[model samples]
Target: MSWRQARTAHVTMTFDPEGLTPTQREGDACVACHKKWPRPRIRIGRLPDDTTLFACPECADALLPQQDDTHSLPWRVAFS
Candidate 1:
């Protein structure tokens, strides 16, 4: 499979209806969990318009979409 850049991992947070901030802040919780069992490297999967950093190797591997599983190798794309 060719590993092209892709974004994965949906941040789980509940929003406060009255405010702009999230009611449930899980960023720290997530990072802390990752830090406890840190991997050798944090893989970042880049998308056509953005970049995303995944905490686990498993997460990195799961970054690619099911539809594009065949083209998961390293390929270059000029995404600005």
Candidate 2:
């Protein structure tokens, strides 16, 4: 599939939390690698409970679409 399709697929997907640790379920760790030191901040998905899942930059890059600045407006500008 193309990158756009892959990104769109992930955007609407929610992850199951049954297999995750407490830290991961709480968003204190990387959902993909379980790394907690730097703290994962990228929103990757959500649990059934609606808790947000996170991942580090490296893992997020692998999981989500790369931001295209040329075709997209920055959030502030877009919102304004």
State every prediction's TM-score relative to the real structure. Answer: 0.25, 0.67
In model 2, the runs with Cα more than 4 Å from the true position are: 1-12, 67-80
* Per-prediction tally of clashes: 5, 0
Q: Among all windows of ten consecutive residues in candidate 1, which has the lowest summed lDDT?
A: 23-32
Across 1-52, the per-residue lDDT of candidate 1 in tens digits comes to 3332333323322223232112112221112134424431443332223322
Best by lDDT: 2
Candidate 2 lDDT (Cα, whole model)? 0.77
lDDT of 1 at 52: 28
User: Candidate 1, overall lDDT?
Assistant: 0.33
Model 1 misplaced regions, further than 4 Å: 1-35, 46-52, 66-80
lDDT of 2 by residue, 2-80 (tens): 2243333335448988899999999999999999989887778889888888888788778876655576667798689
lDDT score, residue 4, model 2? 45
Clash count in backbone of candidate 1: 5
Measured by C-alpha RMSD in angstroms, how accurate is candidate 1?
9.3
